[model samples]
Target: MAVAYDLEGQKRAYKRWAPYYDRVYHKLLADAHAKTARAAAKAGPDILEIGVGTGLVLPWYPEGTRVIGVDLSFHMLERARDKMLSGAAPQTRLVAAMDACRLGLADESFDAVAVPFVITLVPDPEGALDEAMRVLKPGGAIVISSKLGYDTGAMAKIEEWVAPLMKKVGWSSAFRIERIKAWAEARGDVELTEIAPLFPAGWFKLMRLVKRS
Candidate 1:
């Protein structure tokens, strides 16, 4: 089994990835980012994006959307700050260094929460989702884009085999969709509203969970 992921190691990995994040991920995740941002925007104007590295999706939100983004890595937040200053991401209102699992924001303050490509990277994915739910307004949505692991197939075995190696780099391909489903099922206040596959052969997917009104 792979060692449990820690926040420190994850921060360190993002620090190294900070400078090149947008360059490396911008085009590759463009569709996912755009779709996620648009979905969040549909919820309302106020959005909180957890693990908002480099603010790549900030620019994709509808104009007038007020987005407050947080990340654990200062280096990553710094680049995101630059995007705000450069006018590339006008929807961004603030970018702070904060842990996703323990958000320092007011409860029920946001209309939606967007977490793109971050669920598998966090040390506690369910904890992060809990925080997202804690801050989301009733009837609001939590939008997530992630690479989900297969349950029982050849692909499942492959993800399991490479999980340790992937964990070392910062994310786990062994993270399963059932885990998120279980979390939602455990919380009766939340509902799985939508799930759709992204590009690159459905390895990545977008999920939306809505809080009960």
Candidate 2:
């Protein structure tokens, strides 16, 4: 369990999780990742994927779509790079270590951006969203898949009880999709959609937002 929200904490948690993350998380997130990737692939070729954990969605992207993947954890990025070199992720043009909130890329550098299961993990999700907006080209799209807390439900009560424990294990149980929606809407130059969860459990959501700049 991690005790902090700093980069070092992310590295610690991810380094420990890297070895078994695919087995535990891949199956659970497969449907969500696949659905988001399918929609994003149609956006354009040049794509930047933040928090590209283990490159799980790598194989799903279209062949011609070029992708640059960045993650805060080196151990995780190593896994992503391996997938690329092994031909399991031919669309992955590059996999490198970087912070999502401050990627030093040029403005309008990408045709699209993908942020899968990352908002809750990062310390500053709003800053990360702003960065995504900064790097994306006009008319570019952003796809995010996240599991957010329910406001009213027996499960919601359970989540509230276990959130602290989950955080120690490395994620918040209460990250909100509304924050992302509001941010985009506030810009007054974006299109946002709340897609139905691809998985039947309905714990996750796919947010598709397009910059109209």
Candidate 3:
């Protein structure tokens, strides 16, 4: 488990970054969300969105789709709510202060679960994935899109040197796609599929894991 101080620091950092987040991450998120949503079209309805910061992906959801979005940061959720209120995905529901590792939702409650760029932020990603799996109905799918492989070679060296400083200033450690795949596959019922890499040095990957009945 990550220390409470680390978690709180992360939340504070993200809150501070919220204003500029869309500008910084929008292009990457747009491409990834489009591809992931297209692939997830087969899953159908009652989607649960974990770590739904600012609800940027809410607009990309197919028409008539229902959404239940959960987030840890109250500030982020407030922004998401404001977006929703301003006619962004008018039907999407919001849940404030929910932890990814311990979802408050009932088991097998949703048809699909979408988690974009969230795994890397959590301290125990395995626990978070397990919670996602538990809430998804059998045969439902979990769609995840993230910037992976951010720590390698030169990047790894830079991170190793800068991580302590970054953590002190409330930044998260880098994530690797391979780790997420392994975590997903650890669940006995999951069937994993790795999507083609997008721009910016194969850093983005779309992973789809279907839960078997």
Candidate 4:
């Protein structure tokens, strides 16, 4: 197995790409926002968003929703702040330097949690999901949108091959959808639902899970 990507290296890579990340992945990001917003609508009230890079999903958030965004990179958070000032939903709150594996929040504090294209980036995905589940109230939902474990024939193979190189430069791993689903379901209280498609012709996956009471 390849060694885990270093967090500091990942941070620097993101900072370097902050100027171009959105431009290169705008379409995929937009689709994820739409999907996340729709899922959030189904599960509402106190909401938490992990890896809220550049606050791309802010616009789609339901009006009056109590949304809190957490990101690991300060530079990315700064860009998110800029987006918030320019166009993000006014109600969204941004928090900097929050680690996914150890979220500093009370137990069952949120009605729903969202992780958009973020899990694959963490070396300890299970730990991060556990933290997500810990902060969500019983029956609260966790929505994750990613391209993990996806199989789209040649394109999928190409993406897998390119993933490591991208990581070496600062991009997160391209995960398989099945692995993500399995990991989520491994926790007894979590139930997976509504796996959906996004853009790039079979390149993205959106998954919703509800934590059992």
TM-score against truth, every candidate: 0.89, 0.87, 0.82, 0.84
Better of 1 and 2 by TM-score: 1
Model 4: lowest-lDDT 10 consecutive positions: 166-175
Runs of candidate 2 with Cα error greater than 4 angstroms are 1-5, 150-173
TM-score (C-alpha, index-matched) for candidate 3? 0.82
Each prediction's Cα lDDT score?
0.89, 0.83, 0.76, 0.78
| Most TM-score-accurate candidate | 1
- The sequence of per-residue lDDT tens digits that candidate 4 reaches over residues 3-38 is 364789878977987787677766757877887876
Query: Per-residue lDDT for 76 in model 4?
Result: 79
Model 3, 134: alpha-carbon shift in Å?
Answer: 0.5
Question: What's the candidate order when arranged by decreasing lDDT?
Answer: 1, 2, 4, 3
The 10-residue segment with the lowest total lDDT in model 2: 193-202
Better of 2 and 3 by lDDT: 2
Candidate 1 TM-score to native: 0.89
In terms of lDDT, which candidate is stronger, 1 or 4? 1
lDDT of 1 by residue, 38-140 (tens): 9999999999999898888888999979999999999998888998999999989999989888899999999999999888878778889999999999999
Query: What TM-score number comes out for model 4?
Result: 0.84
Q: After best superposition, candidate 3 residue 118: deviation in angstroms? A: 1.2
lDDT for model 1, please: 0.89
User: Candidate 1: deviation at residue 10, Å?
Assistant: 2.1
> Which stretch of 10 consecutive residues in model 3 shows the poorest summed lDDT?
194-203
